[model samples]
Target: ATNPFTITKLDVNEKPRYSKEAFKTSTLQRDAYNYLGYSSTRTMMLAQYLYEGIDIKGETTGIITYMRTDVTRLSNEFVDAAMMHIQKNYGAQYLGKYQTTKDQNAQDAHEGIRPTNVLHTPEYVKANVDVSSIKDEKLFEDAMKLYARIYGRTLASLMAPAILEHTKVTFTSNHHDFNMKGVRLLFDGFLKVYEESKNKDVLLPKFHQGDTITMDAIVSIEKQTQPKPRYNEASMIKKLDELGIGRPSTYASIIKTLIERGYVTKEKNLQPTDQGILTSDELDKFFKDIINIDYTAEMESNLDKVSEGNYDKLSILKTFYEMFIPMIENAKVNMKKIQPVMLDETCPRCGSQLVIRKSKYGEFIACSGFPKCRYIKKEEAPTDS
Candidate 1:
């Protein structure tokens, strides 16, 4: 096996590809979680400030379009201004065609989340946001950071496609074909403004059709199969988006409700509480069909149809009631009662086990031996430091 590697073929791609469109609520949340480690709820809150009009240069005006939208469309005015801005700053060759891709589920009620004015650079917007008016330095910083992302993405969307030289090389030895691919950046088009969080260019060494490669050690590596990862706020929202389960405006509230109901907790990632798992298991045993993810998605789709006047509201309601009323009746009689989720803490007053409970206000910690031991834990509110 002298010179055990031989190059058999080389193929390269000549086409250029553009970067993704501007931020919608789902994409924005995913990027925020990945880059800033901000939760979905927090990201929405920060985005809302930009949309609701910020105090800029002593004047109150909105700096970005509506935040709670799934649409990626840009207005004709915005597209023209952005193209002109690109032509002036980056040159005529860098200008891109104005087009947007949307899924069928998109409402298309508002344009993508973008800076209301292309000239309103993130730095300019931040400088003018009066600290005296906002009164919080951290809030100002977070809002500006998110605003920068939206601005950059919007600009990048209208920039020329990045030209890349993708080379695929095949090596042959002992009747075995091995493949390797490399890419070189021919032109950094949209990349000038917005850099994607994942993926980078890999430049490969020059290879001809007939070239010999020196042999390296061949190894069969053993790898352990990884388990499916649990979903965080961003990933959970992504899943929901794919399933068309909830609207953009409701995503933050939905996640917030999960936390408030004590079903989910925020740690390194969004983790479901043990109580949450128990409740899910109990519900699945009794109402698996009603609470299924697919069923939820179907219900959402039906609601959309009703809103669009394509489906009859009464007919849908009738079908739902026919399927649901019997389940409710059966659950009332046959569903087993679940035990309280006890905490590791013991009540100071009666030395009884403390447990999590839900009330009008929200979840709270109370004694498991409730009627006998009337103990409730009061949490101190966090103050701005």
Candidate 2:
């Protein structure tokens, strides 16, 4: 029956949930992509400048700490300052309990990305920042926006969790039960600093148990399960973080390397090119056991252990060599070589046929007779990352 029904049971509960600790490298990149539409490379570049120091007035000021870090814990000094700021600017109740990182992948090398000084607000940075010696206007604006995000996130991390009152209503008819849920904001704690669209509350009309409530109608909505979407730069970083595939310092470079090599192209999402697919397929065929997520993640872990003095770097290198050296030799014997494309033009240097050869950079024209004629046609301008 598509009609109104009496509320059989109404339950409401008040709960408090904390926001995330702070912005780690992965989280910062993800948020920047989601909120500011900034690429990982772009975000990291701006963050580097901010960390290196910005010129405000006559003195140089470093607004943010190191950009590449996995840890979410702020320094004790920063936390103490933030707490004071929170208590003074925001109410005393806004002060939050300290949170610690549980991520096993996190290194203690650096604290999470945050403002070096809480008082240097976004507005201050916007008006005072100079990105270059000549002072780029656009760079100034982008830097300001990124700084604001970091500022808000850092303060929010040290604030108390938002309190919420959730109410659920259940109705039963003909053995079929329907449910309605509502949310009410009880306290804006961390939300005072960092705001998100999801933080909105859905206030419901007051209803008691066994009260008559109008359903309006029971309409059937057809929905199909959709396949998972491709990873954007942000989501890709997140997946890499989850798998522990790379370090904080390497995430930007990893994505940049993939894109630079023509392996992956960044459009709306990160799409693998033909070269990437073929490379992966060939590697999988010959080195599936070794060239995999598990191996990479394990190597990262070993590297971390080495950094922490828990494992020997030489032993790790020896173990890796034992496994990788044999694979290279086996591949050389069995794997098919990618033949270079022969170019119509001949090499003027050695009177040999020129061929198109690919490297980390784009394809370049080179002599096929490499041992005899080591001639390469240089491009108009060379570019290296």
Candidate 3:
């Protein structure tokens, strides 16, 4: 069910748009969040260290601009500096017109993520920064890698758009339609630096719109439809951002809490444990309003309003507590403890029944005789269908 499946029919648009702005925006956000698999909080923490003064070559200097920003707007001074750096480094052809589009919900308090000095290339930083003096070579290395990503992305954002030629070929045979697509890069433009945006080129034979093509071979393959994928760290953060459940500053802490508690495990993907499921079920049954997605999103919006001075903080708190306090008391009195589920298998190390136990790392099988026989094993994750 997790494997890829074959497609039978494909229809191509007459005039396909080659612009990648819409796709780039979402991709960049994910890339930034997932930088080095660091949680949003970790990324910001490391970024802050870079932004704050670091002892480098007997001088204290910031390596990057402010990192806690939801807006992508750059100041005129920085924009001009980036343009000059781009022109000097990559020639005038790579330069692009600077334009700022404001997002209504964006908190434009600081400039978007960018290098403090555009000319301070990642290679130069890696070569010059005295790792021995810093006492942390790995930290300095990671900082350089992250700086490169931000530098490339910020510079690419201001560079010329990549030009691509998309060609789609569709064929009709026996009342069935088969299609193939081809994409050729006409110009690299910004893709020269940000190679992650480049898509694999699919070349197809030349054919006119009305032309019919013969098939070389035909085969039927069996495949199953896969269920929706579980959220990883990057996707989870992206989802929270899209749902307006948390602000940029809180994303990392929120995920960290889930992991620190026994709610979710980040083994390969974020998967809820038996304890998490039970807790969610209880909350859904007793305190649906407070634990609901919509309610939480609305609360976030209200908090934003308070920050903007549009809503009173005390009034909002009072209104929330009026209903929340009763629910908390009711849950405290009525909530039941979830019983451990015993497995058919016995502990490998001890001759005792194995039972499912929940921990910070999720569900695992442990010997029933805990203190006497401290043997435990990780439970296998379920396959998606």
RMSD of each: 5.2, 5.1, 8.7
For model 3, how big is the CA root-mean-square deviation?
8.7
Each model's TM-score, in the order given?
Answer: 0.79, 0.81, 0.74
Best by lDDT: 1
As a TM-score, model 3 comes out at: 0.74
Candidate 1 Cα errors over 4 Å, as ranges: 1-11, 168-180, 203-224, 305-319, 341-385
| Residues 348-385 of candidate 2: C-alpha lDDT, one tens digit per residue | 98788899988876788899998788898987776797
Clashes of each: 0, 0, 0
**lDDT for residue 226 in candidate 2, whole number 0-100:** 98
**What clash count does candidate 3 reach?**
0
lDDT at 141, model 1 = 86
Across 141-208, the per-residue lDDT of candidate 1 in tens digits comes to 89888888898899999999998888999889888888888887878898888877756667776678
Itemize residue pairs with steric clashes in candidate 3.
Answer: none
